[model samples]
Target: MKDINYSEVNGYLFPNLKGREEVKVNSYFAQMKLKYLKTNEQGHLFSLMAKNELSTYLEQVEKEANEMYERLVEEFKVKWNVTEKLKERDQMEWVQQMNNIDNVVKEIILKELICN
Candidate 1:
């Protein structure tokens, strides 16, 4: 199998918005979306078919949202780093941190998308 580097991913990387700030904002929005969706679905806000149809639609949305969220976070990791210095080799650490942040965002998006 061929190995794929981070830079090879589809889409342009963000030159800025590295570290915790970006992650935090994304996470917050994802959570909000999840909460809203859950409430709406539970309350039968759609007023369409039965619960089965509503649940199916919600599942599809959640799946797409999760995929997008994961891609965005991976891109962020590749673009942002603590330092470019070769000797220091801290960029990898930054990448790891970014991955952690991505997890939080993914969870929020999953929940929100399902609910909403």
Candidate 2:
């Protein structure tokens, strides 16, 4: 019996299968055949299908990774802006405290000079 290539069979059955869906189906059948079929012809066909599937999967992963990196960059920018605002608030508080201390010291000096 001639070994059957299920990926080719599927392509014939789903002539309209295109894009990721087609790749996914091909990959799934290729994996199933690799697991269950022992014939040389089926093995070769399945191997080819698997290679195409892997290429498609890698492309999808790369696209997702780029999107995730962009999201992380935006998040980092928001966090940095918040951190800068907090630092500014802290500096303002420190200056206010210094001015209060200076006023208290001036009052003390004036009191002493007037008394003496």
Candidate 3:
């Protein structure tokens, strides 16, 4: 049997454990989707498992999110005129613009890939 770790909370020990179906979901998108599934859609997640497509589904979502992020960054850079020249002229402006783009992309990913 696998070992279970415990956490002591106020002199009480509680088993720090997860379920047997431990799918390895990496990347921000995959993690978000996994959390959503575990919290709100266990039946769907288990259905995917029974169909032998959970990994593939997560992988595809991760890939699509990553690709969308990259593409959005490139597009936003061009659209917002965030270029090497701007970066060289003002480092703060470059950073702010990049951060904005990142936030927008993450919002898009959350709505399109994760929440839904």
User: Highest lDDT among the candidates is held by which one?
Assistant: 3
Any idea how many clashes model 1 has? 4
- Poorest stretch of ten by lDDT in candidate 1: 16-25
- Residue-level lDDT for 91 in candidate 1: 61
Candidate 2 residues lying further than 4 Å off, grouped into runs, are 1-51, 82-116
Instruction: Return the TM-score for each candidate structure.
Output: 0.40, 0.30, 0.76
Candidate 2 lDDT tens digits, 52-84:
564454344445444544555445445444345
Q: Is candidate 1 or candidate 2 better by lDDT?
A: 1
Candidate 1 residues 1-116, lDDT tens each? 84434442368643332233121213444445435645765455334233235444445554578687867676655665424462266667766676676876666665555444
lDDT of each: 0.52, 0.44, 0.89
- Candidate 1 Cα misplacement greater than 4 A, ranges: 1-35, 38-51, 82-92, 103-116
Q: Write the per-residue lDDT of candidate 3 for residues 2-85, one digit (tens) a residue.
A: 687999999999997544454678778999998999899999988887656788889998999999899999999999999999
Better-scoring candidate (lDDT), 2 or 3: 3
Clashing pairs in model 1, backbone N/Cα/C closer than 3 A: 34-112, 37-115, 37-116, 38-115
- Tell how far residue 68 is off in model 2, in angstroms: 0.6
lDDT of 3: 0.89
Q: Roughly what TM-score does model 3 have, to 2 decimal places?
A: 0.76
